[model samples]
Target: MGSLMHLIPVTDPADPRLAAYTSIREKDLTSGHGGRFIVEGKVTLETLLTRSRFAVESLFLAESRLAPLADLLAKVPADVPVYTAPQDIMDQVAGFPMHRGVLACGLKGDIPLPGEFISEDKPRSGPLLLLSDISNHDNTGACFRNAAAFGAGGLLLDERCCDPLYRKAIRVSSGASLFLPYAHGGTGLDMVNAVLNAGYTVWAMTPRAEAQPMQSLPVPDKLAILLGAEGPGLPDALIAAAEPVRIPMSAGFDSINVATAGAIALAHVFGEKQG
Candidate 1:
């Protein structure tokens, strides 16, 4: 177990030391909180301390939460500070009710490049998930959860996608975004090409009539599944670049949620791998 001596009590909401947590909702609306992102709840905090590659700057906890999170708190590095406050003060500092009573600021360390992330030297046993223009945080989080649950090697997101580290995205992902290896930037084509050059077969998912049914093909040794935004879906050029595969659906319904589609496709490939 960890020592509680590092816990600092914060009675003032406007304390300069707690500045990183101020106006969280408003800050989340904008981008780039100086390479730092906030994570909420005990589960995510535990994931951050144990599984995530990111560094924890500090932890803010409500007084009532301290006893319940003792074991998890013990994992915090000695150098990091743990700030404790009453529920009211915590709510005031965060600009809303912090029902979870736990929050931590984490540093976004050096993110690997797409080429480096998918390098041939890196040994991986599962497929990769390539996302394009997925702006919804909930959808982005769901994708990460699906990727992690189904044993994806990693994920690659296009430039237009929302930050996986976003507060809501991290929560929605149930902290999968913290540990899952991912690189975000460049166009959808850039992501597809990177994996392809790394000697992986790319499966571009589409609902077009000409696309091959997913069940028709065998899972490759190295595969990358491509998913796009809800309404617009994958771009024509991107779909044309890889083996177009579709999940067989009803006559009128041509599509499903991107995250759901990703889960179904990943589950199919995962089951095949196990078999």
Candidate 2:
């Protein structure tokens, strides 16, 4: 019964109003759609409407999804348009079969600098997760989910990292990317230096023999856990610049997936905080 529940029927996949929703898969891989990112699925849509810091530009849903999402759609702002289409039109617009039957375009507002995001003035609870050259969307999304789960203050991604706002990444994150405050730019070393200058003790995660075990170190008042892409791992200079820590694994196995490693490290920090 929300005022915004008046659904605008979208019959044509080529409609100008749904221009942002057209060829979504291609757009997701290419450039920003006028500072807007697509959020898909019921959960992500709910997060977009209810909890995300980003503004809901509009929503596109299949006719079948209207009833199931009625309560959630009721929360949409009056200015935001709610467009409904047949499943075929939705699929045609998205360039794929519309299994989820829900999608929303969100405006990416101002992205803060790394230093600004982790500023001393900002009230934060747990360590910040810093990512370097993690180009995989799944890993990027998983990292965000893990960061949110463990109460991490926020995330900082180097320029080489994939877009956490990518549609698949946002969906994989279970919408964590929508709410977790993150800064994605600059070199890995740049992010490390920024946090160090911000008075956060940096722990560069590596699999090197010389790196200390993560659990052995006491968590700092402000900590930043740095993780790099899986195969190459953290750059040596970056590792040398910070305190190197490793999750001890069995013989012959040196490392795990970057996101998994990040989860373990964040969990260790979370455990220490609870203790």
Candidate 3:
């Protein structure tokens, strides 16, 4: 927990102490200092501060919103400086309206590689969501939310997937992105092979007619549900390497959003297990 003494008030948007909060959009695209990422909204800030793996560098909050977070702030480490500014100053610093007025910057923990994440000793008895080329932040976050909701063991993301810690992603996920364990590494094919070697049945999600219906598919003791990018779906070669499955839809519709598909698949997989 943090004390009120840790709080520092800043009226100047350009103050060096507040640099971490400056031009957030541009910084998000270009900054790479110490694996740092932004946590937005009160829910996400709470989630960020609670996790041991993540270390807070600084917290920049709108002055008006500061008192509401006293309990949450008490949990923050004393060494982490907390900065408060008026709404106009925060808006000036972030170059945005700063509606939620809750922002914090923190460093990412040492993330495990895909192989390390799915070790040989760990038996896979539950479902894992495997993502490939899922570039959209919202979809990635939504998938994380769905995975957590359905009691997935973890997530395996291919190299092409966007960082789940992105501000929009975190906001969309409602902070589930921080709670779920995930590994990002290798090509989509590499992930498929690694999970297969780890005793997981990799089920590739596609909208093809030949694919097995998700509801009827047998639930393996260990399963990995593979989702592709937004429009193109999974690569054909990758799909060929695994058991292809699909969510049945109406006659004209070809498919649904990847995140929606993930939710449906996760529900079916977890539901069958509980049944």
Query: Could you tell me every candidate's TM-score relative to the true structure?
Result: 0.97, 0.96, 0.94
- Candidate 2 lDDT by residue in tens digits, 123-204: 7778999999999999999999999999998999988998888998998899999999899787888889999988889999
- Put down candidate 1 lDDT per residue, 1-275, tens digits, no spaces: 55488999999999999988998887862256458889999889989999998989999999999999998888999989999999999999999999999999999876766666887476887999999999999999999999999999999998899999999999999999999999888888888899888888999989988999999998999999999899888999899889999999998999899999999999999999989
Estimate, for each residue in 1-275, the C-alpha lDDT of model 3 and write its tens digit. 34568889998889998776788876662136467778888898988878535678888999988788888889888898889989999999999899999899887766676788988366444689999999998999999989989999889998899888777888798888787888887899988998899778999999999999887877888899999997889999889989999898999997789999999999998888888
lDDT of each: 0.91, 0.88, 0.86
Clashing pairs in 2: none
| TM-score of model 1 vs. true structure | 0.97
Residue 220, model 2: lDDT of 93
Single out the weakest 10-residue window by summed lDDT for candidate 3.
26-35
Best by lDDT: 1
lDDT-best of 1 and 2: 1
